[model samples]
Target: MNGEGKVVCVTGASGYIASWIVKLLLLRGYTVNATVRDPNDKKKTDHLLALEGAKERLKLFKANLLEEGSFEHAIDGCDAVFHTASPVTLTVVADPQAELIDPAVKGTINILKTCTKVSFVKRVIVTSSISTVMFPRSPLGPTDLVDETTFSDPSLCEEKKLWYVLSKTLAEDAAWRFANANEIDLIVMNPGLVIGPILQPTLNFSVDVIVNFINGKNFFNRRYHRFVDVRDVALAHIKALETPSANGRYIIEGPIVTTNDVEKVLREFFPDLCNDDKREDIDMITKTYKLSVEKVKSLGIEFTPTETSLRDTVLSLKEKCLI
Candidate 1:
């Protein structure tokens, strides 16, 4: 087994993407130290404990991203760390620093600080979002592809009150600064809007978007949506750890699509669930952008078909009785 006798820590283990990573890690025979806010909460963690290798290899630890040493116990002695714990909010709040920035920047720094303290910790993988790399900017040329080289302007995010984007950008920036200064092997995975199956019961931001569409509660405006399977994002984390040559950031994404594109997929595959009434006023636009996957594809990561991902997501929602 690739993960035989290896151990790793996955922060925010109960999240939409992290849960999948933990499961994949366990199946590969790695001892997993998973961090969540409340390890004792069954609603948040029961699904994790029910996984194939949970009994023998998985251990849940309560940790908070805001606290400085919260992650020390969880990350200590692990071979690598996946820092997926961070605040995510799209709406405006009274305090951006308290609610968004502190947990992200300080939390990321805390994880790296622990990694530096532990002699056995070799690599650190941070689950950053595509929002960090791309943002609402002036249109690029048709041939221009947004790649790893481009980063969302923090000032712009702050000015426009894109709290989520600001948090991610600052956190990833902090991670890089810490990693480089301390000479830690850091691989950052920037995934597009991740959707697929959910291991945890609660709905995540992205999954909620799918559910809203299914329920036909239309609040979405015309925007280019980039997507990637949660499963692929999970495997990519493991692959980044296993692949010795893997370094820097990798953008795991698919073709840029629109809400209309996704709606068409849903209405075609899930005819019964499509609510046409709410979508009547949706602005159908052809706006789209290009995201280069050359870096991630270099790691031999092939994306799941967008339609398959959407269909599987809806199926998972049905299986879980979320919709």
Candidate 2:
């Protein structure tokens, strides 16, 4: 909000979280240079085009994660850069490292290299995940609490073959190292499972956790994790960019949630989709995880309540006719 009319570039502008970041920037009157893999792909870009300030303020560029120097054109002359592009998946694939780690780690290096080329760029805000801080659905003590200071041990992720977590952990580490070595201004926002309303017509990764549960597609193990509203994470990105004192990593986790909470919320809004008889199978909040949010709170953010987020997430899906 401090620098109106300033130019900003957001990579993966069509992604689950990046779309919200672009929306917030456009609404605030910033000239947004948004990068997608294909500028011609209507399916990937139509949601962004529908945003309030998209017509006059939004500019789309074709960029790729693996291609070198692809982001240089879009980032040139921008005041700030948001590196939000990364691979995400829950299903186990044939090659984990190649699909998840390679793009995330290499893509981060490429973006930072672009920053060095674009000398006028003031700061880089990276959208890192809480996986960089803690492992989800992994064993933890009852009193254990994860915060920004905690860095996940990649060995465990490797042993368990948790590709998504390993990818995020490696990517966040790579970004911080490159920024420090090159003396580039960098701030990282580590958010937990991002869930909320949809901007893109396609289903976002976080939204799937809820949709699958309501539809009873969850045949595998039920993951217990914390969640944050996507909109709040977007605000944290801008706040970190504008606030001078904001530095290093900030935990943007919301409420600690369980499968039981998911069932309860769905039953209240859509009884047709809910099967109350299966509630006995869901483990109550006997085991929960907590993250310290005092640092992000200090940045003057008022997080939306989890109940409100869950309600909006379902409503958004219904409006989109995706349910």
Query: Count of backbone clashes for each model?
Result: 0, 0
Q: What TM-score would each prediction reach against the true structure?
A: 0.93, 0.92
Q: List ranges where model 2 is wrong by over 4 Å.
A: 136-139, 217-220, 223-225, 275-289
Whole-model lDDT for model 2 versus the true structure? 0.85
* Model 1 regions more than 4 Å off: 136-139, 268-288
What is the lDDT, from 0 to 100, of the residue 11 in candidate 1?
A: 98
lDDT tens digits, residue span 1-323, model 2? 55487999999999989999999998788989999999999999999998988998899999998999999999999999999999888687888878999999999999999999878999999998887787644555567776787887788888888789899998998998999999999998898878899899888778987787778654334435466899999999998988888999999887656566767788787776653334333433324555579999999989988878888899999999888
Q: Alpha carbon lDDT of residue 306, candidate 1? A: 89
Worst lDDT 10-window in candidate 1? 278-287
Q: What is the lDDT of residue 200 in candidate 2?
A: 92
Q: Which candidate's TM-score is highest?
A: 1
Task: Encode model 1's per-residue lDDT on 1-323: one tens digit a residue.
Answer: 79989989999999999999999999999999999999889998999999999999999999998788988899888999998998777876899999999989999998999888889998999999988887646535556678888888888888888898999999999899888999999999999778999988878888887887777754455445667999999999999999999999999887767667788888865677654443343432223446689988888788899889999998898889887
Error of 1 at 168 (Å): 0.5
